[model samples]
Target: MARMRWSTSHTRPYTLRQRRRGRERIQALEQQVAELRAQLATQWVQAQPTPGTRLDTLLTLCSALLVTHDLPAILQLVVQQAKALFVGASGVLLFLSDTTGQMLELRATSAGTLPPMRVYPGQSTAGRAFLAPRAMLMAGPELALALDEQQPAQYAELSNLLTHWPPVSALLAPLRLESQRLGSLVIYGGSRAQPFVPRDLPFVQALADMVAIAIVDVEERNRTTQLASQLTQTQTNYAEIQARLDTAQAQLLQSAKLAAVGELAASVAHEINNPLYAARNSLYVVEQDLAADAPERAFIAVAQAELGRIARIITRMRDFYRPTRTELEPTCLNEVLRATIELVHTHLRHGHVTIQHELDAQLPQIVAHADQLRQVFLNLMLNACDAMPTGGVLTIRSTNEPGDASAASIVAIQISDTGSGIDPEHLPHIFEPFYTTKAQGTGLGLAISAHIINQHGGCIAVASTLGQGSTFTIHLPFTPPPTVVLSMYSTLS
Candidate 1:
């Protein structure tokens, strides 16, 4: 009410003072905001890992690879480390099928909820990761849009986990090296606060690469160890075989030496026999010419008696080297074996060799040279006696092989000895000329016997084992006897 004179200039001075205070307050508030922003920037720098620390973590993951060769163990480790690096994410390591590139196997997982499952390369989040060369991120409707409805279950399982966890985003990185697509590393965002970002893709991809390298190294090492074991076994077998061969060669040389000595003895006996026969005849004539009471006649008679004894001994030696008849006849093989055994019975008893005959009485007659066949058995018997210098059994077996009407009838004769068995190496050459195992063998006996049997359409085979025994098997075909020739003079008479 004191309408006294209102001074506009005084009011202007108060208004200007208020405006100046307001500007000072605004400046102070702006300075405080700038300081807060700087503090936030520093905090962000501190929170993020340094390149060196991140590299060390990656190296630590790589070092873990050396500890195991198992594939599942390696992949589990990879997923665990990936979840730690990518904060608030559940991840899986998938392995691609070598045969079908479309097949994706979820080998390992960071979270334990997902059972081991298989998915297709074009059908699910893991599949798309495998198909793509670089890292990719999907969020919201993109996950559903990219999924193949035809493979609903595989993609659906992924959807269900996502819905339950309700991740804000999902990321995928390929486990690839050059052209080889090993598999994919898949991660789903676990929370909105720590969602998967574009910056995280490179680190996930780097981790995938390290895992692929470890897989290749483990497989190569397993293959190398297997090959080395196989090579060592092969070498051991080869050495054992070589040792046996050397033993056989030494036996062969011993057999050859005995045959040479026997040949020399036979030749010397043949040269001495003729002269000794002439000397015995002269002594016999001198005994007849002298008087009965003469002293010289008595000396000549004694000389003739000694000479006759020498002749009988030489005849026995000649009989063994004599040639045999070549005529064939239908004869019983068993009878021929018995006769040959009789001839050598005295010598066998002297050498302490026992003969055991296992004759097949039902055996059919075979067309053979009786004299020659007998000689063959006799030679075998003598050889058996020589083999058993310390005494053993000589087993002889004869059997008729059963056959169809159209097939040829066969006879199998086996001569076995429980003597110092022929060396396996020497057994093969037993029928070769001048090859023998005996100290006094002529070596022509088995060779000549084998020839005769072969001429009669037969085969002979021998089997022996060192320190065990030997068996000589003879197989002969049944053949009819030859026609006998008659003289015209006999017919006229």
Candidate 2:
């Protein structure tokens, strides 16, 4: 009995230990089973279609839409893809007309015998879809009933148009980008067995959203291109207008300066005339009193000549402000040019300047004051000679510019010199009186030349490059009108 009792105690402990180990093994097996169950559940969920798959599809559709730029192509692609998403389905896309916002026009269709239809807002099924905020799914009977109740004429028209390929059900979604309601997209099912379900609404709506995005993007890009073109044109016009304004302002300022200088010159000439006359008379008397053979008599003669020259200069100054009417006659400009050149031939020779003439042989005669024209030519020639201090070619050209319907014939004379050119900063003021770059200049040569040309109803212009050369161009009409001559004489007198 003792040995049996001892054996029972030991067997009981071993059995208890075995039970604990078996229980632990069962618990471990249960844990493994739970883990396996969790893994299977995850795999099953992964295998099924989820929102992420839809998102990836939407992203792919968006990428496709973004690469396309044409509006019609984009709409056609959308409808075709939507139709492809469901079997036995036809798709149509409608958009608001750009010209008339009140009407929605059929833009693209995948498969249908429907005519090109224009629908008014709040009138048809597509219109209602466009006005709605979210997507809608309607059975074919319900759609027809609503169409008949809302618009009988439209329902009859649609029935006639769709008799060949009638719709059994439809999924509609509004094309909207933010607050802008662009249009609507509709997918029509032909078989009742393959009717679009509620789950199809989100996908159709996504396509509609893509259409809206594509349309808005294309339109915005077009508008941006137009605005950029307009901006460039506006800038060009502004620059041209500003340049004209600057020219006008400079002309006005020049006129003001000339008027002020004329008044001052008249006053100074009046003040100096009396003293100059007295000195000339006294010198003449001294010359008459001295003996002809006396050395002092030669000095008196020179004094009289100097006084006479000063008087002539003073007279020219007076004529500048208050010119007398010099009689006009038929004058040959070519002849006048020859005479003036002869007078300055010595000076030009001493300056080592070579003169080249390109006179027009058939040049016609114009009515002008020969002496005044000669003086202008002389001044210009002398100035040209002075420009070429070291020696350069002086080219004189004369051409007769024929008249057009708007302009009369004129004579154009160009005098060009290969000499140091005028500085750009000094070119604008060169014609103003008392403006000169030479130390010994009287500063009245160009100013008087401009005035003389103005009185003759002509114009003079100069073009110079700082390092290249200079050209002075004079344009004279074939004849000044009688009224212009008379007006000029009257104003100057």
lDDT of each: 0.72, 0.76
lDDT of 1 at 455: 55
Candidate 1, residue 129: the lDDT equals 86
Worst 10 residues of 2 by lDDT: 1-10
On lDDT, the leading prediction is: 2
Off by over 4 Å in 2: 1-60, 97-102, 111-116, 149-164, 275-324, 402-407, 423-429, 432-435, 439-444, 465-468, 481-483, 491-493
Query: Once model 2 is optimally superposed onto the true structure by TM-score, how far is the C-alpha of residue 91 displaced, in angstroms?
Result: 3.0
- lDDT value, residue 407 of candidate 1: 73
Per-residue CA lDDT of model 1 for 174-211, tens digit only, reads 77778988788788786765567777777877888888
Candidate 2 per-residue lDDT, tens place, 459-489, comes to 9899998766789888888887776578445
Instruction: List the RMSD of every prediction in angstroms.
Output: 13.7, 13.9
What RMSD does model 1 have?
13.7
**Candidate 1 steric clashes:** 0
Q: Which pairs of residues collide in candidate 1?
A: none
